[model samples]
Target: MAKGQTIKVEIKRQATPDAPSYTEKFEMPYRPGLNITSVLVEIAANPVNTEGKETSAITYDSNCLEEICGSCAMLINGKARMACSALVDRLLDETKSDTITLAPLSKFPVVRDLAVDRSVLFENLKKVQAWVPIDGTYDLGPGPKQAPQIQEERYPLSNCISCTICMEVCPQFNTQTNFVGAATIAQAKLFNMDPSGSVLKEERLRALSGDGGIQECGFAQNCVQACPKQLPLTEAISDMGRDVFIQKVKDFVSR
Candidate 1:
């Protein structure tokens, strides 16, 4: 490999949800600090494969190019990661391969190419009621205050970008289990710890106790590892698990 050489990229392409998947190999001039999104942009400009055949532009989701939106997650050389932040130099240095591979995240059904329907994560959040409920839009003055200590503890959990990377990497998050994965569980714990949000605590716990609930998590610790936001996922999962268990016990005794 010489300076200013071209980097070969192999991108998986699919025209539609029902279309069969195909691969399109591209060769773009290598640039220092070039990220995956930039490479795709270059491909879009040329729209030619390594074999010099004309091809359709690659389709992928990207918003907030700074990695906050979490929309650019894809399989980069077999690793599930955000395309925006994955540096090409680092990738080349590590893999020692001039060719880069891009593919859609596999855990979810592809909508087109890199885009997949992630509404399941949102729906799961709804199932857990992952929010602080407020009644009467009329101005409620001076809500309960959270101690700094509590705020400090809850802040890390709030960092979840809803990327679904955690879910994608989790073995429990599959069609058979319908497990909600760590992000949703962390959100459950986030809202449950809020003084105002705790009003519906019992209901949230009950929701988690049902099928596709917290019990589904295998505690593989993959979520904690893959979370880009460095959220305290396992801690939240452990805390929520204990709380859900307690709620179940109380329900059993009262019944």
Candidate 2:
């Protein structure tokens, strides 16, 4: 690594959803500890391709420059990852290729360049009712106490940032299946475990039983591997599956 070395990036670009896609190469001055977001900012500043032709700035979603926002997820060197957390040095070291590649997440509909419409994840969340039901702002007394043991178990499931990396890597997540994927399942598990939130447990279980629910998961285990927050997705899926099964049995008996 020498001073004045340039970092090469190959970005897949599309003007609109129906437009033809193309790859444009960019060269930026190498800087220590630079992330992919910073590299895209450099491209935006110049808006010139490697061929030195004037081009439009790369369109991508980014905010909270930190990894907490989870809006900067993209394919970096053929992997679904958060651009804000992906370090250039580590990426270069792993691929051993001078050029870095950026592309939109494959499982989602591309809105522009690297920014794809991730609203599907939100729609799925709505289907599951993944929150505690509460009424007006009237003061409710102290809620039921949860044991420390329960809190410890539910803590890891709450770390999901909804980045959809799990959905991207999942084999079951596609147009044909409409599988909700692991994040929503993990979230359902989180709420179901809560003392106050579990009031809707039966409804949540029924939601997971219908089309595009937990049963659609193929258990390829890709979600667990792809999750940046390291959530216990497989375990949550297993637990939720069991709960859904029990609810089905109870409903059958009552009917």
Best by lDDT: 2
Error of 2 at 199 (Å): 1.0
Writing each residue's lDDT as its tens digit, candidate 1 over 110-201 gives: 99878887889999999989998988888999889999999999999888888899999999998799798899989989999899998889
lDDT of 2: 0.92
Off by over 4 Å in 2: none
Give Cα-based local distance difference scores for all models: 0.90, 0.92
TM-score of each: 0.96, 0.97
Clashing pairs in 1: none
For 1-255, candidate 2 gives per-residue lDDT tens digits of: 445898899999888988888899999888889899989998999999989999999999999888788899999999999999999989988988778999999888888999999999999998889998999678898888999999999999888888999999999999899799999999999999999899989999999999999899999999999999999999999999999999999999999
Model 2 TM-score? 0.97
Each candidate: RMSD to true structure?
1.3, 1.1
